[model samples]
Target: MLAGLLSAGVPFPKAIELADPKDLPDKFRDFIVLAFELGAPLVPTLSQLEVQMRHEERTSQEIDQAQAVPQATRTLLIWLPVVSFVLAQIMGLGTFSGILHPVGALAALLAGALLFAGYKISGRMLNSFLAPKPDPTLSLMVLRICLSAGEPLEKIRKRLEGYPDGGASQLVEISKRTGARLSFLIDSELEQLNQKLLSSRIEEARKLSVRLLIPLSLTTLPAFLLLTLPPIIIGFTQ
Candidate 1:
């Protein structure tokens, strides 16, 4: 059905309207909706659309995989304390006896909680990393600089294609997707993007984040050694 729509040069939104929701894959539905809403231009080169679709699908699958694993792990972690307590009781070990004594059991419960919390925090961080944050003014400035240096839009896009973290490249990609004129899009969208980035408060947050990383990494090594060295030394002595 999508192929037929492409052949007929039907707009994506209209094609989606014509398609049966039950017949369409859930993953493709959002892309279809976005295309329709944005009125994304059709690339003459069908191969480009194919590649983009595949990349998006792969990314979606990877995110699903990550979410699935963590959910399953969390469920198992939640059961640990309950299971440990039960087993101790069943084995006739006093509540404060066995490897999982009161203190050890408390530590286990805390570790499990920390693990689940860490996973949730990391997932949010990963989503933030993946979502595009194109700054329109900065993008326009970059484009103008490139153009002044004798580069065309297409050439500039190609040059920045490999700049994975570039805000300008993200704006260009949005233009490519929407079939909008890059310059016009940049001018119209710059203010909105700037507002969003500012409201997110990421700049101040990033400064603090960067300052923490070095100290965090530095502290980790000594802490890890302190925790592990005694066990290693005891094993060797035995």
Candidate 2:
């Protein structure tokens, strides 16, 4: 039924509407419910998806910056303690022969402590580096696209009604308060909104969101592969 509605050029939300819940598959019912909750209006959703694509592109670029610093710092932290321990053992060989060098051991301990401190500092900086920036560009783009796609401000507001999850919801409220169309709001007042909500860190925030995709992708792939693959690869070979 959904396929039929889609074939007829109906929007996903509308298609779901046409297909009664009782007639639809359980999996499809879940999809429709999610779509409704996400405030789908076909064209608006397409526009939001486009914005997400752009965000992904920007995020890839930022990932390069994060990888160069944080990743290297984490590597250093992991290897430093092991290297220090090995070096101490190597130098202590003379101590077993009654030739202990207190100065050398102290130097090794100091070096290890310095390395550990550097690792901790770098880890903190990296955490800050990946934190999200409050960029209204995505929200603005979504609003513009929804308006351009022939959705009235009122209808858009209605769709976003009572949604308080920030971003989309906040914009919807702004539109209601200002009594301005989305295009005008974005073109004329988005900068002011940025100033008010993001202060001076807007660009940094945007960069961080972009950078996060790299680590997120790196982490997600392994987990996804683990979940998808069978538990046993080779069953007790003879």
Candidate 3:
């Protein structure tokens, strides 16, 4: 609707005012209006948003690839206790009581602790995609857009109060500088910022798979042993 209105030659601010950002953060309502008043073009902001969506898609694919095996392993570990119980009953071992005997009870208690630990680990693994943090790159890109248009850094900071999480560190000295040379400088800074953001995400994904292994070995493996090993030994001895 905003695009259609803009195409129909409705003034940019009026077009934005007429269009509602449903389900979006209300802070954006003021942020976008401020951008228009600063003479920033809608095209650049939309282009940056496009870049972000693409990046998120790529990141999500990476997360799924990284999480698949760990998730399967976790599911198997979590359910082995139920399977162990059924197997014991089928083999003529006294069902829950055989597993609930004093020593067996100790084992079950330990297994419960490990199950809880494994649950926490799995939650963290899954949450990498589910609970997304604020993207620092987004605010940086907006800074680039507004600064390239010659807006002052102080004004940008004031407008960004409730927007993306970012700091004034990068733009502090930048505000004092100006001229034809500044365009090249901004381009270099934007490139560096993009690289930093991409690299951090890549590192995080790489670490996730390695980190999940600890919980699997420490908690899930022990959990499986607690649920299955005792019954097997008792079944053989009896």
Clashing pairs in 2: 59-210, 133-205
Candidate 1, residues 1-238: lDDT per residue as tens digits? 5546766889867765785544545434543443344344433222222443454455456545544543454345344444554555465544333323444444445544544554455446545644654433433444534543455677767654544333677667887799977656654554454455454444434443444334333433333332233323333343
Order of models, best TM-score first: 3, 2, 1
Tens digits of per-residue lDDT for model 3 on 13-115?
A: 7865787555334434444555576676665554444454455556667666655755676677667766776787787775455465666678878888988
In terms of lDDT, the poorest run of 10 residues in model 2 is: 229-238
Error of 3 at 180 (Å): 5.6
Which regions of candidate 1 deviate over 4 angstroms?
1-3, 8-14, 20-47, 66-81, 96-238
Which residue runs does candidate 2 get wrong by more than 4 Å?
1-40, 73-100, 138-181, 184-238
Weakest ten-residue segment in model 3 by summed lDDT: 22-31
- Scored by Cα lDDT, where does model 3 land? 0.63
Worst 10 residues of 1 by lDDT: 42-51
Clashes of each: 0, 2, 0
Q: Who is ahead in lDDT, 1 or 3?
A: 3
**Residue pairs that clash (backbone atoms under 3 angstroms), model 1:** none
- For candidate 3, the per-residue lDDT at 55 reads 58
Q: Candidate 2 local accuracy as lDDT?
A: 0.48
Best by TM-score: 3
